[model samples]
Target: MPQLNCIAPKPEHGSTSDPVEGGLSLTKMSSESQNKAVLAFPVQPKPLQLPLYPITLKFEEVVYKVKSEQEGFCCGGTWGTKEKTILNGITGVVCPGELLAMLGPSGSGKTTLLCALGGRLSGKLSGKITYNGQPFSGSVKRRTGFVAQDDILYPHLTVTEALFFTALLRLPNSLSRNEKLQHVEQVITELGLTRCRNSMIGGPLVRGISGGEKKRVSIAQEMLINPCLLLLDEPTSGLDSTTAQRILTTIKRLASGGRTIITTIHQPSSRLYHMFDKVVLLSEGSPIYNGPASTALDYFSSIGFSTSMIVNPADHLLDLANGISPDFKHPTEQSENMELEQKSLRENLKSSYEKNISARLKAELYNSEINNYSHTKDASIRSNRKAEQWCTSWWHQFRVLLQRGLRERRYEAFNKLRIFQVISVAVLGGLLWWHTPTSHIEDRIALLFFFSVFWGFYPLYNAVFTFPQERTMLIKERTSGMYRLSSYFLARTFGDLPLELALPTAFVFIIYWMGGLKADPVTFILSLLIVLYTVLVAQSLGLAIGAILMDIKQATTLASVTTLVFLIAGGYYVQQIPPFIVWLKYLSYSYYCYKLLLGVQYSEDDYYECSKGVLCRVADFPAVKSMGLNHLWIDVCIMALMLVGYRLVAYMALHRVQLR
Candidate 1:
């Protein structure tokens, strides 16, 4: 083959190049070779020309405090907590077309301030935050998008699937599904994620896309809505230098599209640091320096903190934030002197920032507010554009979430280990019971009881881990106002039915016949329905406990104890109880379900050969008599109540989980 130079293709006529599998095709520059070559390198398409909703985010005197226990005579002479400040009068502004970075070490309240700006934080917050000269409103929330520090994505979902699902739920109801999907495509292209568009977003166990790509996917999810004010918490948390730089570059391009971008960065390399338009350096929850990125060094130097040419500005800034001079390296220095000097540096930085930057910023904010008031029409138009409306209908959200959940959880629900566990138990139970005769009333009762106990523990343990595993993802999505909690809860409650029922249906089909308890179709169908109903009730109880606790180990432990109690009082292992605790059987759903199963399998007139030739009613038998198969409808009604009741409890518990 002749020598050929592969040149990245540029958009023609201000439109993106024709997209290929992984990316756009590379154009051959050599005359000797006329054929085009395909290159897998991701080439960012021209920055999307999305409709700009210019937002000016401003916060004045933003203060956040948390309760700290203190031994003090307060609150009517009782010991009370004191308010501990987290963010101390932090103030700044990020206008449209600017990339502002909040730089600080751990626990400096960078994330807290970002959350306050995004309207995601609520606890003793005293501040005035505005978007487009208006206070933070539902309209502002709808227009703003917040990307969390961790990539809270479904590991099993492909890049396109994740963004598409986000778009389906988050995009306004005015837009058609096709239009929403088109937006997802645009975001994928704009972020240069076309190469990994079909790749899975992997977790710790399952390998999928790269770390950088996962971060981009997180960013892309927010970008799907074309948010005006985007707040990202440490978007480059765990990426390498090159990937981090690329991410910053992409963010800079986004800012160029007239979107106000605020991101919290723990530490950034010099090259990555320069990509930001403005920098806010915080120290111990106080603003040390707030100014242009290029002029941060000069501002700090003017404030009596200067760095040498060899030192990185970010490193030097962090050193100053820590109350240590960047040049301080004297190991033999006196400890008291170091402490006093460090305290003095912090005081000086805070005072200087207040006098120089904070005062000027306040004046600018005042003028901006005045200007915004003067131009009432512009403010009205912006407000009209940002007007909050239900993004998607409840039904639409439910459908989308249901589909996404099923797709994301298929592997977990049907993986080899889970399938093996269910199948092995089914086979073992089948062989052990192995078609017992109708005369063996005790054996049949034992088998039915074991069935109830198995489902009770099985679905409960499996479902208890649901919310804990998804708590972070849930918080992240809800904070963005993507979907109603009702929609998510309903979708989750119902979505797992098919996946959860499939195995039990199979198990019932196999074990019921293999054990040969009931040969009649009516009886078999009723038994199967009761088993499925019990599974749902157990799953609902698990959901409730998980939502109530939101801790995996704690929820699992509680679920185990609860199941053990239900199993014990289920009228199988223990029938007779003291009058005080006899009511416990009524509390156990297992008791009701087991009674229903027996009622269906054996009728009142059914009899078995108890003593070879002597016939006796099945109901008169000890195990059957204790359960008393009478009131079958009442038993089912009680189970039905539990099916709905437990889910309602789960929903109520989840509601108490603050979305803010």
Candidate 2:
């Protein structure tokens, strides 16, 4: 095995400097010494420690493993499980004011290492990841900003609205509402998103901002907090060359502000490659090269791996990281042993990294551990730390979320299609049972039962998509310690209440007088209340199902079956269910609400003409008899309990959701 003695040395006064085009700072590296030129870091200034949190991020011997199940028979075994390592003995250090880029092919654990550095990984992780030589804690989370590869903004909100709401929810209570808005404006201006501040963040179906703008908005969202350590996972993954350059330029500016930034990039151009201060090349969960970005080519050249053709440095490095030498040989030479050759090359690279770079990284980690006490004792740093568990009060979170939710969900809840659906149903029901006389006993009873079945599953389907659609966004916000889970759950549930009830209220008023079921205002009011109550209970069930399953297709299917079962045993279709399974009606909220609605419309002494002059009491009707209103209050109590109980289940389900 060959040895690599590449370590970045301090820069001298007069050295060959490579300046990034388009106004980025110049990078100085020594050209006089062969050893110094092979591994040289740009001379970055000492970070200002006045107002910002100047901290270092370091990881040591980080290892992560997961259990993978084998399905087919292996060595006479029917089924087997094995522990697969995702990241193996990874080690690196990133000081404040430096931008480190992780370059690797797909499935090489670039994102996994990024997530581990951000304190987002959950299980089977063994490592020493520290910030400013301290363990990851709540304060460390507050100081860290993570921008995921996928943009998680609400599609309905404008750019300004999105950032403003985030500021409200995540910023400390010490800042007033006006100050938060001011900060949002500053961030928008800094990210160059002012021209499209009022534009909607559209999705795959809807057209809104461009790809570059959306990516910038994602970065601006994290920048609002002025985090000391920013970790972005492929911010420029989907953009073109020009746009990608702009995104990296913006990231470079952020790093210039004394914030430590790390990102994962795949196949970057030459211009984009040199913008990073350091680069870590990974292959199959192991880092093949970790050194200054500008000197990576020179470092590889000394080890019998140099590219003669003019190509992008990053492209050449990626080829080598993939176990392919950049220097091409004749096609006929060594064609039969290509596989064996690449395997040996990969092993050589890995072994060389372990011997050369791993020792120096461990020494740096040791020195950082010794200086951890000085960082903790800094009085100025301690003053800026937040001691409270949450940034805002519970009521403040609810208020902000309520306002935001109402704005976000208003169009979906009150769209013309939904309005048309409710109106069409109301009018059709009114015409079918128009102004029936007191003699028709069963017709009015049937109308009330249909009301129970329609509202039963309508709101259910609407609320079933609440959590699944926002699962990614919820995890992002909660992991940053934005607000309490209770605040978000209550705000979301409460904000939808009025919107959920509006259409049903209009429907009830439309059909109540048109069908002439009850002429008095008191009966109409009570019927409307019961209808709204049933809508809430149904919506709560939908929320619970959505939270528990967290998949739209599966949750919708289960909701369909659950609502159908409730309708079948609701005392209307089947008058006398089998005694063995009769208790399902007790479980069905529809049963209780239906019985209560019937109780309000008819009395025990009310009589109606059943046949040609023969009369019968309303209570004697089979539907009413099977579901007698003797304990109407019990039904209301049960429905009330269901309303509260279902929401609790949903809350607990949301609380159990692991944030990563």
Candidate 3:
């Protein structure tokens, strides 16, 4: 058995060091020398006071099966369901202080294997995975860090702010604020992200950090907790060669510090390939080769798929694993034999590796290591340590999440376009119904109804995008055990309240006086409060739609239809709806808001001259009584309850749908 050793550039006396072009120099050695070198340098960093227990992840006979439904057009798009095997009895071991790269073609279960190892997949999985001889549990999951390929981050937050907030919610409650900040700073330095620490992590619309920097930020975020096992899926998928190499270099350094790293990479450069300590080549969920990366080429050569000096060993191995034979310009002496060899290459490689002596010896060594550590007393201590939750207290989680939510909403909520839209609507409505006379009861009622419709529509429309945009981030964070769904939901709902109220309050203040609806101070105050609560209710509805649908277009369309229904059911429109469907008015915030506004203005004492010649001064038009809106307080209370109800439903939907 061979031990993994970190390969660093050995300084040459005459050679000039060029950081960019002068790549890290490597020296080949025998197994004995490698073992000696491994023992010379400390695997785990001693400076960091945090525990870095060596983790050995062993998976045996792992199998994952998923039942998927395929829609067929024969029976009016009926679903034809079947069980699919994703991982087929795969076996491997990821030792401590090593960098393992899972390589395979598209749909080869690289991501699936990584997910199964990290307990992220949510399907039927059968396997025995042990961390230092113990079964995988919540404690192991807490101590492990998984970074998905997509960088799920808040684009509005600066790098420092993002890391700081993550630390606040993720670190234990025993650590002081300054201690958490120190941990964040250490991670920032370790990942070389200090330069862009203050820059915002922008997205497609807003330019911020570069893609490579964003990936590093993602790694830094996970590194905050200092987990022993770090798993990443396609960490360098979209990065350029240079950037990918740099990221891999950082990963190698981390591995040298005793963290077990398992990353799935696609089409890595030769330089990046050499950085890995081991490689697991999978073709259609079956391992073709799993052993020391340095010896992989020799293994393949011994199995009769020799590679030329010009070809990268990793690429050649992948080609063979994918059942792609090398192009031969000239025909061989026996073309039939050559074709047979090409067809059987993948199976031959898999069979050869399974029967190889080195693989068996490695397995024996792993078994011995597992047995050696299984009976140790450290297991209980590690279990007790794992018993400590990764998150802070419930209230602390709320506070930290609230701060993050408020900061994000403040940056996202008050965009120029939204502010401009609100002001435009206010000014347009004010001009259209300018200086309304109390005697023109129809015009006054129309103006109030328009206000209700505007407030309700704008808030709901904006709130529709909130949950959709944050859905990925929320799921990622929640799966990491950084915070609970309730904390996040409460924080988001309450954090947006001040800003949600601010705009509507200002809009009502400007439009009320301009429209000249009953100028009493009490009427003005009541109208302001009603509009504020109406916007809140609309926002709540938007959140619910967003959470339930998980698609921006779907949520927006549903919200629009819902708002249109409320608008139609509002008291001003079709005041005499049929008795069978009249109950729908109770569901419309617009209806309650319009009824309250009408009640505030048209009291029993107020009288207006009828336009028709048959009747004169019409007193107490009976609009409020006819609609059965006698209790203003009840309308307000119902609106408040609706707000709570929508938010509660949204929370439940989010909790149910988020990744477990």
Give the number of colliding residue pairs in candidate 1. Answer: 0
lDDT of 3 by residue, 184-215 (tens): 76788889998998899998877899999999
TM-score of each: 0.89, 0.89, 0.87
User: Between which residue pairs do clashes occur in model 2?
Assistant: none
Query: Per-residue lDDT of 1-660 in model 2, one digit per residue for the tens?
Result: 121122222222233321100101122212332132212222223310113555577888899998998767557644878888999898888877789999988888999999999989988999798776566767667767899999888888899999999989877776656556666766888899989998999888678999999999999988877777899999988899999999999999998777889999988999999899999999889888887898888878877788888999999888877778886453656665886777788889898888877787687667656755453445324433543467789999999998999888867768899999999999989999899777776788888888899898899999999999888988999888888889889889889887799999999989878887879989999999999999999999999999999999999999999999999999899999999999999999888888988999888987888898788888998888899868888888888899899999999999888473
Against the reference, the lDDT scores of all candidates come to 0.81, 0.81, 0.77
Please write out the lDDT profile of model 1 over residues 1-660, one tens digit for every residue.
111111222333344422111111222223322122222222323322345456667788998999987775555453767888899998777877889999987999999999999988877999898765667766667668888888889999999999989988877665555445556777888899989998989999899999899999999988877777899999999999999999999999988877889999999999988888889999889998887889988888877778776777788888888888867886775698888888898888899988888877777777766665543345455555545556778899899999999899878868898889899999999999999988888888898998899987799998898888888888888877778899999899888887689989999988898897889998889999899989999998899899999999999889888888899999988988778999888989999888988989887899999997999998788888988878899888888899898889888887788473
TM-score between model 1 and native? 0.89
Q: What is the lDDT of residue 41 in candidate 3?
A: 28
List where candidate 2 sits over 4 angstroms from the true fold.
1-50, 74-78, 328-340, 371-373, 377-388, 658-660
Candidate 1 backbone collisions, by pair: none
Worst 10 residues of 2 by lDDT: 18-27
RMSD to the true structure for each prediction, in A, is 8.4, 9.8, 9.5
